[model samples]
Target: MSASNQGRIGVLLVNLGTPDSPQTPDVRRYLNEFLTDARVVDMPAAIRYPLFRGLVVPLRAPKSAKIYQQLWTERGSPLLYHGLDLQKRVQEQLGNDYLVAFGMRYQNPSVESALQELRDAAVSRIIVLPLFPQYAAASTGSVQEKVMDIVSKWWIVPSISFISNFVDEPGFIETFAMLGKAEMAKHDYDHIVFSYHGIPERHVLKGSHNGYCKLGNCCNSYNKNNRYCYRAQCFETSRQLGKALGLTPEQYTTTFQSRLQSRLRDPWLQPYTDEVIKEYPAKGIHNVLAFSPAFVADCLETTIEVGEEFKELFEEAGGKHWQLVPSLNSEPMWVEAVAGMIRRN
Candidate 1:
């Protein structure tokens, strides 16, 4: 195919957003937009808005701002910068045939703006790749909803498609496995933990195909019934990564982390990362290597929560050498994987 024929494809890459700045006000603005989204919070506007703005944002923002302050680096948010890097390299890989734009679901470089860029390029079709490997209502679903909402109003709409979930994609599995292997080469890790962001239990049930998800060992295997179930997808991603890295079932544990609020009565995906980390030292599992596969790039959750906080917990509990295998941020294989997925879709 000539370059002109390949130019027919437009690619938009989306990720969960980050605050523009680590300042309290900026963080508050981010929290306000992110939490207020019904897909993330999953409550009616009456309850969601008031509770998030009045209670959650106020309580979380300043503390989160401080955490963000620590998380920020010379290039600003690692998440944003890495995403930009991925965009540039992926564009190069796809060559002149593709126009690749990156955007966040919440803050700067908003999803609408990214889609507009693609629309302006006048590509015949646009493919949206939400960076979340495991689909969830709050992440991928919200992006799908917003993209359709924006394009439906266009005077001339192109054929829009979404690459929703790619848990079984070989490129994704191989890339993550390679990262894990690199870390393993440096340290004799006693155990591996695959941490993914936690969503409310209701989110899983909402995606349940005829009650296939019971939130237990039901996720041990992947199948059509639980394909879109975020929890199941998380497990599957871990399973594939584990298999790729030559780990047995007992050698690794897959758990959820970063629940929205600890006080919320509603349960979330369990075996919380924090709780599980605390128990590891007592079990004689020292020297752990952690993987945050759900995140394509290292962000607050991977850098601060998993790398720092969990390391502290493990050390305090008498463990030694807690290390984090960094996320795939513009890693060449990852870029190739993304490009191939785009071509396939």
Candidate 2:
């Protein structure tokens, strides 16, 4: 490749971040920034600020910091470590043609830094790919907004393209299906549950172009009316992966997990993780496996929440087997898949 052609395309991988350290201050800073985003909290700062600063951060930070302590390893937060690995692997696979960078939406190695890396490389074209598989305003859209904010200030902004979502991408489906099938083969599970991260119904409505997202079958249909609906995209993710794994509609179910707060009128994804675990025993389902595809790397949500908490609940509910399908953390195939996706774009 000619010197001038080097770094022609920049691929930026963005994910929800983790604290720089397990300390309370670091965790608090991370959480405060993450929760305060209008897309994430979806309330006026006048109202949400008090709740987040006075109540949520103060109360949750210490506890969450402890959780981060447990999750932190020698390489630091698993999310950051795996993100770095993914960036390296994707860069290697893409050769010298593409400049690859990774960033977290919340904490250290931020979107700003990633864009700066691309800028420093003098990339001619940039592809911003949020690590979120499904399109959620809080996650993917937030990343998009930040990327635009930075690029808009650039004196020489290159051709910029944002990947809206890749829920139905063949490589993505194959990667999830391979992992799911491998997990299933290890145990004869009676039920397979696809538990994605939850978002408030109002967030969906805010992003909806029309009044189409009712948060019900409206999502399941995957039509133009519900195209950008996060809930619908999640269902489509499950449906496509299940079909690839040869799972019958009755053999698997989709639910949302990791809801931090409750809404009276607003609906989140139905059949929360705990409820699904509790009801499985009554249905004669002794074995269950959970796939948290919402997260690209195993964080507290996947490790403690799904692995430990849900495992205990299923065991208490008379379930004999409980397993969690692992996240796609720089697996070679996944690295190739990400590179392929970028190449196609």
Candidate 3:
């Protein structure tokens, strides 16, 4: 690469994918690919493949398709479009010298194609930022693994870097805090919930640095020791947002949601969002605002699951009000935060 091209750095932003459309067949195709990833399921292929394809996808696709329909907008999947816009804005921030591209770990606008775009740009170095603020094997790890698998086959691989996590990034926390503060001012919510997507307990143990995470209160504190622990990072992000928004410990709680079905009774992070919402009413916490910090964009999980289904549950439990704090989505601060991460890397 020439000196001019050497300065032409490429930044690729990766996000968890969505179905190509809000239809059953497309949803099933997406579910099949997403669920079958070894990083995602992590079970013996003999058992995992059969169960995922035979029972799970077939049974769940239609229901999930309906949820996707609810989440669909005029531009289609919010996740994909927001991701695209983020890519554009970050590129604008970096100017013409940097090539900023976006890709999905699965489904449309794949990592492979995005890599090709960077390669075509003839950039000397590449920086990949997985859109998940907190790291997990199922999300960030999977994206890193796929990127390497593709780049390894290239005739020449340029210098490539990966940002594994950004849970405590100041700008990131500030963006979420800004959103939460706006919601707090809008409603006199009785309690606040930071609801993150749930992963199997085993997954945490597998990623634990020398078994540091006991999957207990040790995860409540964030430090170099438990830095990569997904649960710990989630709590840390919550605490930072709480501090920024001037929320008391008694007024807010962190919970997990969207756990997939498993044959074994392995526990995921708790208290479950659905269960917590139901309990809120009985605890005299009638009005609440929930945040899905795991997601940067409103999708099936954040929009349909937390915003819709959880609201229904809380209302059914006699809660007077249930509100969902929207995800960052292409917010100006979030875009700037992402650009900062790329520039810093």
- Candidate 1 lDDT over 278-320, as tens digits, reads 9998898988999998899999999999999999999998899
Sorted by lDDT (best first), the order is 1, 3, 2
Off by over 4 Å in 1: 1-7
lDDT of 1: 0.91
Give lDDT tens digits, candidate 3, residues 249-334: 88899999998635546888878888888888888999999998888888888888899899999999999988888898888999
Query: Cα miss at 81, model 1 (Å)?
Result: 0.6
Give all candidates' CA lDDT scores. 0.91, 0.87, 0.90
**Model 1 residue pairs with clashes:** none
Residue 36 lDDT, candidate 1, scale 0-100 = 92
What would the TM-score be for candidate 2 when compared with the true structure? 0.96
Worst 10-residue stretch by lDDT in candidate 2? 260-269
The lowest-lDDT stretch of 10 consecutive residues in candidate 3 is 260-269
RMSD of 1: 1.3
Query: Which number leads on lDDT?
Result: 1
